[model samples]
Target: MIVTADGSAREPNFNRHITTPNMRKKSINMMYQWFVVSLVYYGLAMNSANLGTDPYISFAASAIVGIPATLFSAVILKYLGRRLSLSGTMLLAGITCLVTALPWPANLNWVIVTLATIGMFASSGTYGICFLYSGELYLTVVRNIGLGSNSTWARASAILAPYVALLGMYRREYPLLIFGVLAISASIAGLFLPETQDQELPETLEDGENFGKKQRFWTLLPQKPSIDNNSAVEQ
Candidate 1:
């Protein structure tokens, strides 16, 4: 029990514990999302050399794509908002992987490599946007905890990424199929995240509790115009 603002004693709300359902749901969603993102991102890198090109050349190509992807993410984050940018990139990455799943000539290994490279590029963009978006999702007081936990998922996914690529030993397209499905799932999960663009950050636990309470959809719509209080006073 504690004194209230009016000096009345009250029992604390035990329902809002760290293990509350809301908190658990948010944590689990973020964990899965980050896991899939890292899996696809690193899977592409690990499988690049197996696309029939010289190992050095394929690795170089994959590494180089990150440069442009990082540059493009700045523009996307500014104009497109965080949710759309992340979801769209993840979807694009998934699509590229799916394309390679289709049966193609053995000599078309270069095409497969190109598509995989594009997927990696999009995944890199997702990486940049996801970190920014996730940081904004949690309250400032627990920001590090939230991000650190999500990053732990990313590391776990990275550890599994090589095994995902190793599925190529069974079938060349197996890795692509798995990564493609995971990327698509990540994009779908992204759609559920609230848009944080132009919104004030939550500075306290109470402030964060109500964050994302408004479940608005199709965030790309033009924002509603706000009335100017100063203009009303002048009038």
Candidate 2:
């Protein structure tokens, strides 16, 4: 394992995910991912609020939504991809949340609730996609830990969420806006990672590289070199 600048030992393997020969099918798998995940994830989240007309209804609706919603997540993750599922969930959740937050007709409260529910449904799908997809994508050695890390981080958000809500939520619509922005951000982060819907476990570093692909990261560079031969490539 190579030591990164921060002195941490990076994974010895290069391919961050498993590989599948059928690239087309694997990539196509992504399309189903987002919508499916959103169906489950955001569904549960919104149920606590969007499920009904008032907070109590929302709470009751949220509880009701969780039952079938979780089951659906299981069903979809069995068929869809990890990356696509997650990204789709993020996008749909973000979009729908944004839509719900918009200033529309007073009569449209029901419409907003409907829209919010749809986003919640998609959120569950995303949760499934992320867990199953990433687990299968990575090699055996790191698979559990990698997926675990991801799962932990995700759970952390949920755990801390109530605190966040308690801290801020001045406006009635503020939480929706926050959720919308967060969903968008998560989708963007999903794009930065690799796609591993249906594939074989990567055996070598090169395999991981081929699968994961380079992504945007911070870089530090020194100034340009001088124009001399001693400074060879200098400007």
Top model by TM-score, which number?
A: 1
lDDT of 2 by residue, 1-235 (tens): 7899988887687656645443333333333233333333533453354323566655554456555766776665455444445666678878987787777687766676677666766675566556566656556655666555555555556565554444224544566666677778767656555644434457554464466443222211111223557656563
Candidate 2 residue 99 C-alpha distance from true site, Å: 1.2
Tens-digit lDDT track of model 1 for 20-93: 45545666777788888899999989987556657777788789999899999999888888888988999999
RMSD after Cα superposition, model 2: 14.4
Candidate lDDT scores, in order, read 0.82, 0.55
Question: Residue 149 error for model 2, in Å?
Answer: 1.4
Clashing pairs in 1: none
